[model samples]
Target: MTAVSPHKKEPYERMSEPMATLSAFAAMVKKEFIIQLRYPVEFVASFAQIFLIVVVLTLAGLMFAPDGVQSESSSDVTGLVVYGFVLFIYLSDTLWSVGFNVRREQKQGTLEQLYLSPASKFAALASRVALTLLWTGLLSIGAAVLMSSMLGELPFHNGPLALYILLMTLSGTFGTGFAFAALTLRIKEAANTAVNLLQFGFMVFCAPFFPFAALPEPMLWIAKAIPLSYGVDAFRSTLMGYPNGFPELAPIGVELGIVTLFGVAMPLLGFWLYRKAENQARRRGSLSEY
Candidate 1:
């Protein structure tokens, strides 16, 4: 160490704010919680929407059942249908809300500020997704309880199995969410309308109401290919005691693994694309125009 140059230091000696990433993430998550808590209407509305849908579906099932279809079995189907419907709503809400949220932040200029910060884009997105997932999970559980009480039957047969299925389904849903969110970074016009309109197509093409077999040939194939289709199918398997129909859990595991991998990787890729788009917008002095 021939009189180590005074200006020279070890590679690891840079003066960095340790734990800055974690602190930023924690702060972002906390901010999200505070904002969500402030809007009690959103909290109430989520449950209300799910409750109303369950009622409509149950009443319709009761009205439409064949003369010999057992009332008890119809209730099970109703519960499964309600679960699927609520899950779709919860997942779509997470994705579309992120789109609207990014739009609002872009309009208000906080989005650019977030981009300028040292916090990683992935970190920022994770915080938002965490908040969204929390709301989705909570509302889903609450809706399940309410539906069980109303239907006078619990859909879950195996607690652990149901939980595992739910987690896998959520993994696939989050992958879809990442893809949706990535679309918002550059194409900001008609964002709200886009989310709303897309919801219908999503529900249909994903086959949430009925099995893919009931869809037309082309749509049936398309539905089977979608991530949401797997989520809905797996959910039904768990809730309807039809796990054997889902290929004995191995395919479920594989799909879940693939979805989980995509879930982690897609958001990072989305963040990269989002930042590139944002930077291009700022370079053209059009950041606030959206």
Candidate 2:
């Protein structure tokens, strides 16, 4: 009998090039943009809701002012206070918007399908966060400016402050969002409740309505420890002409540094937790169960 030839096997595939990775990222980004465009209601609602908040706050501020003075001004305490309020709203809202979107996708079974792709999960998540953050920040700032203009003026001692606030806000908000996204991977049912509670907490502790000094001795330090407070402090200083607020409540540089570290760490941590949750769901065969 003739000897049988050993079966030949195909060579291993080559690693993907840098261009291919960029292409994958671009594709995911496009997909996110398309989804956002299709759901135009969300954008409209976001704009309307922001506008309503601005109007309500403006009226409330006017009502509470000592008289013969506006809630916001180029100089003095009201502008700083209002800036703090606006900053807290912006940061808290950004986190909620991203968290809710993640929860919805998780429930709809799309998140798992996203995991099935060969592209990095972090890249996909980052793209989504980037798009949402960019749009929401713009909307929030525009609303704040328009409202302030109606009531008074924005009180920007320096226009560069806007860029600083934007960077710091993006860093802190996205960092916090990563933590929430990780939590959702494991605790889908309680995600919204958790986010709502956190949002309220930020409003109370980190916003202008309350001063960091007003907290109890123990809690005063705790408030300063939180990232959102640093954000509020930064915006308070820059937008409200309260530059003296810097490096006191919290330094802008330190907050930015901490937030940057969190930005890097939280996403990595989130990705790891997400993978674990995905595997657990898959093993239980409940990937699409929500």
Candidate 3:
């Protein structure tokens, strides 16, 4: 009888599973970049829109203060307006990246393939989130600089502190976006409408463009309920030297704590919800239908 060799898997073969998962995630990020670059006009339009928003806000600011008062409050308001818009842009873009990406995949009939892949669903979602964060973060910085220059005000006081606040703000925003992604998976047909409504709701309730204290009592309660409200307060205080609207708690630290809780809780909740929705879709054999 011929010598029989015992069947054994190679070391590389054993490692192939994890390696493939990483490769898939990396490819997803690269694909996002490529897709954005393929439409050069859209890329340019994004930047143009940022610049136009700054111009309109600047004009309004000038009209409000034609003499350009040099008071501290005036300077703070200018910084608040500029940086607030930057934060809003980042939040909106992140939400779009997560929610719209899922909707697009479903519409193209590719989402089912992703769901069937060996890679974890969260990994795929995170890759898109990372891409959006990088793209929107750069745009936010550029927009902040342009707004500051046009408004004749410098917003960066403590560079390191400002950077920390920015990261915290992004964390909170990403959590919100992650939840929106789950919502998109559940409501693919109305995903765009949901996203638009969310953006508008945030603008009104979070008080990104205005002072939280300026809001009425009922609205103030709504603002307090939203984590982005705390994020905006922290960002404004850190980047613009503005006073914290919620003075009951210790300035930036308390706000950071609140956002940290949100940043941690929301994503976990979103992931759980997403997995359930995905499973339901798979069970119904409707993953490709949406």
Candidate 4:
């Protein structure tokens, strides 16, 4: 028989890196829906629970007002509480949605197998983020509306600017979620404890329920050091019409600069750290271990 010509790679087999990445990402986005369908109850319960907790907290906060719940409410206090609560809702969910989810995969023994597939690890991480953006974004809007009714009509000002800062702040928080996911891979079972500690830190340092001015001078410095603090400051201040005593952490210009940098840089840094951790785990063959 004549020598067989060298087998040529098919066009699909020769897909470029960018196209391969896009295909993997698109598949992973579909995988998000598959996972949600498999655990429909957990998904529904989470959505309900977040809404309830926010309503209760906002209602209870108004109760603490010298005059419990009124037809009309103070715009300043209303904006401070409602806006802060909005950010809190996002951060809390990000912890569970992105960070806790990685630990979940470890416990299910899928984290390792997921990597064995040709799909990009970044696709896996980004898929969870897509879930958070959709899931939490809805919860935030619902909770905010409910809180506005319970707390008071919230001030809406600097609409376009507030939207920008809101997006930037959320972007930075997503980056934080990625970093925490990296932490989960390394710590495995300790993820719960770590999440609790992180939540407490956010509550205390970020002062999401109260204005930065309410925090003591010493405590305020800690908030000042945290970039998310600037995000909170800039977000609420702009939305509240920049009333006196707003943007307590820093000047609006300075805070905006910090939040922009945080939005741009954190995701890049967080993903880099995740890749490092992942490469190490793969090399050590610990990728499958819970």
Candidate 5:
């Protein structure tokens, strides 16, 4: 009599690593949408909330405009405010959503089981990014169009370069999201506090609502040091055709270099950090601890 094996490989168990990772990613993305659909009210509320904020901010900018100074009627001002808001929407969503998902998994006690599965951890982290991009893409576009109509025509120049900058900025933030996910694994629920701190911090330091020159000298110095600040500066400046005194942090070339480095390097570093944090959680037997 021949001994028979008891184990049976699942369908995708036979897939190559890349295919398996892709399959897992697609599954998680679908799961995210399904989960999201369970709360239609939240989506409506979110859209309304963002739209209100955009209206308030646009009005406030017009209110603050001095008659002879920084004309609110200037499309330059419109592009500055609206364009920066676009990056703010994305960065806010990326940072908040990614970290929140990780903490949720930890509390649900599935974080450990997820780590044990053969599915790519990177893909799991990326699924959150995919969802954030979709949700924020809608919110940002709505905000932009509404603001453009209120503030005046939007200046869109250097089209290709502006898109490249936008892509790089988004990619860079995705990497930051991964790093935040790593921190969530360690900090657990305290991650929410960190998220608020980061959310407000990005608003102030990244200067998504106004020009960097409007920042106090000390704050401008701080903004200069943050890579995302360069992203905000470069993106809007490029889109506005590098008008007088634009790209406030550095030369366009220098800003481009920094953003490119951030887009390239941060993902590698963030994923590496996430893997380290995850391993520590698993080995310490604290993956399920909240």
Candidate 6:
């Protein structure tokens, strides 16, 4: 009788981890939604905040327009400002949600239990970020519609391109948040203050509501170095048909190239830092120490 070959595991059969990760992600998202639903007033407040920002900025733009002529240039500027603010909402919401989530869990005494679970940490964080982005995206679209109607023109020039660029922008923003989350994991008590300071710094230095050219030379250089600056300019170019805020700094295409590069690089770096922090925390038995 011929000897039967022993049953062998196939190389491609290692999908259990990914399947487990997916299951964990779905569960996390469901839990987040349920918790958020319990706080409906929070959602209402979030929506109101975006709406108020757009309305105030739209009125300011109209009020400052020379002689209320609503020249095409002025309209384009208004569109750019509105789009920038919408992007700001997305960035700030995602960053704070991801960065502070761990601290929130720690404060609730759930961080240790979370680490005890077999689910991937990255998967849990990704699900939280996804949920945050989904709600923020919805609010942003509503704000965009309100702003566009107020300005009497739609801001988005290329729907498909704008969507693609928005994804890239979100990816880079997520990376930044992921890195911040790692820092929060290491420094739980300071998480809220750190996130708030970072948000304010981004608002001032990133020039989300104005052209990069309008910044002073030193500040302009600093803004150009930031990925969000490219994202804001790319959004305006794609959504408002405006020239890049700094053509002398880089063409729109090159600016997007930089954004895409950060979109790829930052996550990898953040994940590495996250893993290192996690291991260090485990070694020190400090994951629950807050």
Q: Which is the leading candidate under lDDT?
A: 5
Two-way TM-score contest, 1 vs 5, winner: 5
Candidate 6 per-residue C-alpha lDDT over 1-290 given as tens digits, one digit per residue, 9 for 90 to 100: 98766886565655588898998899999998999999999879978988887778777767766655353335566576777887788788877888888778877889889889888889878988988788988887798788777776755578787777778888888888888888988988888888888888788777777776778898888887888788777877777765544333567789779878877888888778878887888899887777
Model 1 lDDT per residue over 117-207, tens place: 7786656666777777777777777776766665557656656765666675665555455555556655777666767777877788866
The residue pairs found clashing in candidate 5 are: none
Q: Each model's C-alpha lDDT?
A: 0.66, 0.65, 0.76, 0.84, 0.89, 0.79
Stretches of candidate 6 off by over 4 Å are 1-15, 67-73, 244-248
TM-scores for all candidates: the values are: 0.79, 0.79, 0.87, 0.92, 0.94, 0.88
97 Cα displacement, candidate 2 (Å): 4.0
Could you tell me which 10 consecutive residues in candidate 2 have the lowest summed lDDT?
Answer: 68-77
Off by over 4 Å in 2: 1-17, 68-82, 158-162, 208-210, 214-218, 239-286
Off by over 4 Å in 1: 1-18, 66-76, 243-265
Per-residue C-alpha lDDT of model 2 across residues 1-290, encoded as one tens digit per residue: 98756874547654577666676778877887898799899878977887887677667666756663343443434455556656665556656655666777777778777767777766666676767666766775677677667666556665586466657566656656766776676677888788889887776666555456666777767777776676666656655545454534756677666555654565566566656766787787765566
Query: How good is model 1 by TM-score?
Result: 0.79
Tell me how far candidate 1 lies from the true structure as C-alpha RMSD in angstroms.
Answer: 5.4
What is the lDDT, from 0 to 100, of the residue 162 in candidate 1? 58
Which runs in model 5 stand beyond 4 Å of their true positions? 1-13, 66-72
Residue 234, model 3: lDDT of 76
RMSD of every prediction: 5.4, 4.4, 3.6, 2.2, 2.5, 5.5
Best by TM-score: 5
Give the C-alpha lDDT of model 3: 0.76
TM-score of 6: 0.88
